[model samples]
Target: MGSIDRYIFRTTLASFALVLVSLTGVIWITQALRGIDLMTSQGQTILTFLGVTSLVIPALVLVISPIALMIAISHTLNKLATDSEIIVMNAAGFSPFRLFRPFIYATCVVAVLVAFIAAYLAPDGMRRIKQWDAEITADVLTNILQPGRFAQLDQNLTIRIRERQPGGLLVGIFIDDRRDPKERVSIVADHGTVVKNEGGSFLILEDGNLERFEIDKRDPALVAFARYGFDMSKFSNQGHDVALGIRERYLWELISPPDDDPVYLQLPGQFRAELHDRFMSPIYPFAFAALTFAFLGAPRTTRQSRNFSIGSSILAVFGLRMAGFACSVMAVKSPFAPIVQYLMLLLAIGVSLWIIIGGIVIEPPASLIESINNANARLLRLFGRPATA
Candidate 1:
């Protein structure tokens, strides 16, 4: 690469990195908020909250990288145009394709990043998130250890602890259970402790009394007990052996799922769609960079502004991306639908290359420019200023 190529490559890569991080951080906060309950209500630590939330960053990057690349290329080209660097380079015998080579290099770099994340990092992160969630749900003590707050462990079960002392002692424990249709049970205990073993977890209550109310009877039956064990195993097994979603599976797994896999066997189209989507994801950065450069990187006269070109590029990129998304969705219903995604990407790349190599300059139509000028003149006249001729 020449010195000019290196300069543009560095500027574009830096801008892409900055935009990628900014966008991912903003989006991560929104997504992480949904998991805040793990800290606020579930008595989990801040580190735990961050760890679980950070696992989704790889997936977010996979989605945001291509958009960031487009923005970065546009910004770099705009800067060059505004500074007259592009005009100077063009006059110095630089072709549009030559000017775009640095951006192509940057795009290749981003494509590799996307490919790594899509094929490996994203799936691994999702798997970790799933495992973390399962562990959290199975940790019955974490769910019920919040003192002075009623922890709803199940739809019909709630537990509250007044205070917790060192050495695993709990004081003033209250339990409510209405899971049974025929009766409701409430237990008041002076002290309690949780015990776990191979059999499962148990909430052992001491110096407590149980009150049982039959649905048919008005009066309640009461029984006093010196020691009682309430089965807490049910909470741990609530979502046992849940199947992993398609997004959580590795790329190879998606391509060749086991015949016994229930989801793939039942909905084969989904697996097919996912397989193609993963393979096609890395191609977007190259296509997006090419399209943006073709639309905005060509040299234009000093009298022309590239605002229209910028807008057109944005619209075209958005349309192409949305079409790919739609194709993925359609592929879930029809096995042949994912072919459209490839076709659209290929068309974008091919058309953009043709335009760039052919020295095509995208400019606003004369009629539109005239209309804008006339509107500005009328506004100036209304404001008591002379209209430009």
Candidate 2:
């Protein structure tokens, strides 16, 4: 690569990084806000909240990278044109196709990034988030046993603690179980902690007394004990099997999901759609770059209307992406939909490359341009502002 190639490559990559980070951060903040209950309602640390929420970033990047690449390419091209660098290069025998090589290099870098995230990192992050949520929910003592409040674990059962201390210690523990119609049981303990092992989760209470009231008997039977193990496995998520969603499955798993897998058996179409979407994720950057350069890469003087070209480029890219999105959605029900997406992408790239290679300068017709200028002048006159000569 020459010095010019290096210069353009570095500039575009730097701009891509800045735009990607900025867009991802802003979007992540909006998404992370929805999970604020992890800190407020659930007894969790700030670090845990941030760590769990940050896992969604890989997915966000996968979606944002192509858009950022398009923006970077547009910015680089506009800058060159604004400074007359593109015009100078064209005069010096540098064709538009030759000038596009550096942009392709930068696009390749972003495409690789998108592919990695879509293939592994994004799904891995989603899997980790699911696991994190499972772990948090399985810790019933921390989630359900809020200090100084009675938590109705079930319609017929309630538990409360006067204070929750460090190291999973519970002070002034109380339990009311009325699940049995034949009996009403209440247990009060000075202190206790939740214990989980192969057997199941248990609320092991020390220095507690239990009083059991029989439906037939007037008086209650009281039993005082030094320690007791209260079965809480039902309330805890231990030993329960959970099915991972489509997003939580890795790429390989999606490709060859188990025949007996319940989610696969139920929503095979969705899995198919997801697989194609992931496969197409990396191609977007190249397609976007092609479309942008086709519309805006031609050497033109400042006197020519570039704003209309820029708008057309933006609209074209947006329409292409929207079509892709529609294809992905339709692929869920129709197997042929993925093929249409591929055709659309190929058609866009083919036409764009043809224009770039042919040195085609795309612009609105002179009459259309004149009409828009006259309309602008009329608006200016109506607003009592002088129109430009």
Candidate 3:
């Protein structure tokens, strides 16, 4: 019994690991292609980009593990059937469900690991990544302007650079800023650089021009060019200060949001959506696992189950899981939607159990077997092989 348990456990675990790694790799490659733009924009090193991308895997694994688990468990069981191990066990009077116990145990362990990542590690890592992005954005904004090109640093400010030298000096600069309606000003300079003055911070325009536009024609404009100076407001919106809602907050904080939390008010829909997602997503794994077994283990075949049950189960699981995720968006806002999702999940569970446990399919017709054999023969012939006797 101990050896059997160990064997089942090892096989199930290996299957789960294989599925997890393969799925993760697919998701990782797809995301990496898209993330390259971000990495390039921020001028991130390969290592930094990899590290940042790794931070999101916890959330991805948390999202995907259950589907992978279901597929893994189903494949393992099906493999046993193909290898005739299931037949040997049945002949020895071991109940059909006796095989699924180790898989269930493994699923439980997977659930725990998933919960930890979803609840804690992912959110923290996301926050750190966001912070780094903010820093990168600030650094870029401060120094990314090119000489002799019209550049808009931000809203209400357009700067034209004549030339920027190796000694960090900006020569022949034109600045048009309309940040303040009451005091819109424009300045042109022969040479200048952002430097700390005795007072605070000021832009010194030398040997160039300054023109302040006036609304009324009677109110004449003022132009000056003798190294005049103007104060520049260091408006900084650091990303560290901006909480990226569920991405940055801990599970507890997401569940019990603080009253003064700006994220809740600023983007209420997104906030609620993520909150509901985290809470509701766990149910999918159990739902899928049961569905897989329910669909497959039932309609058992004496020789080989040539039915489309395997393909059908895969489609059903994929469709149901996708529907659940799509519905989650609207479900979060409405109070009764979550309840409906839960009820539907429960119904699926009961259905799966009824099919698997209640001995659904029994003694399928010989014609069914002949049709399957014929189809297999055709398939083999198409691939240039002989049919079976």
Candidate 4:
């Protein structure tokens, strides 16, 4: 609420927002450009691509925000410190802890908001993105056949479309079926449409002829018909399996799968890793700012650059996060092997705590310690009597 606090808060927030926007723009551009092949192959529009990209922005922001805020506030503090603005505050009766209050408050706000998005919004967005991708793939595959071309649907069937009819109809259809070894059927229709039945797809011929052949002998029998219907049960989805990746599963499904699956096993590790990181992200702002402050705000006469400390802190946080990811990926592939998540957490926390606490001080400010103790402690006495053995 004070003048200096408001000044630092505004400056840091503006810088954080600038970095956040730039990062998002660059990442989205890269994603969209690299996905040109996928869009063309899958027959997805620009709007669909953008919609899918938009769903990931929340997750991206959740990833970069803690580090950005840490650097922004740390650099702001270091600039003030290196330029003797902090000395002015101290002369005006401000303590070191007093200067940290604004940073702490800002970190708390970022933490809670980022946690909400990372935990709830990010997963839901991921599901929507994957669903859209699946739809796009199916649409592309279904449109593989065009008119006036001999299109091979699969090994068992080939279709030739002579003309397109109104209202989702196909005219002049020819189908070759070669499933049975003893009998083969070839059908040609003059004016017909491909239709779908409750059981399978069928080609209804108004004026067509069916020729049946025997594989044992070179004999062909032709039947002329006014109206004939041919069954397309050959193309029925019978021995085909639709396999989707773990990224396609919902949270509950990911956690509790119906079967013992390789994909499910791999996903829990990723899910747990992400869940832990989200829970721990809010803590990054404090630890990173503290570490950078201790190193960059040390009694130095001049700053190397306007934002050196901020840049350094951001780099450090990113490095640590990547390290965590590397370990989590290994854990996902291995079975109960190399439990590295805890190690990654401890490494990050340990480095930050070491950098901050090595030279400065062990104790928090009186107000902070008092508040924490009061908020956390439980009464250990009965009838207001403190008894100890």
Question: Highest TM-score among the candidates is held by which one?
Answer: 2
lDDT of each: 0.90, 0.91, 0.69, 0.63
Stronger candidate by TM-score (1 vs 3): 1
* Residue-level lDDT for 17 in candidate 4: 80
Q: In model 2, what is the error at residue 251, expressed in angstroms? A: 1.6
lDDT of 1 by residue, 86-150 (tens): 99999999999999899999999999999999998999999889988876755766655578989
Worst 10 residues of 1 by lDDT: 234-243
Which regions of candidate 3 fall more than 4 Å away from where they truly are? 38-42, 141-143, 146-240, 266-272, 298-302, 362-389
lDDT of 4 by residue, 137-241 (tens): 443122544567887766766778676544335567787866677888888888765455566656578788888888777879899888887665564442235
Segments of candidate 4 deviating more than 4 angstroms: 38-43, 78-83, 140-150, 154-274, 303-319, 333-389
Instruction: For model 1, name the residue pairs that clash.
Output: none
Stretches > 4 Å off in candidate 1: 138-160, 163-240, 381-389
Candidate 3 backbone collisions, by pair: 148-161
Q: Please give the distance, in angstroms, between residue 172's alpha carbon in candidate 4 and its true position after superposition.
A: 15
Of the candidates numbered 1 and 4, which has the greater lDDT value? 1
TM per candidate: 0.80, 0.84, 0.69, 0.59
Could you tell me the TM-score of candidate 1?
0.80
Clashing pairs in 4: none
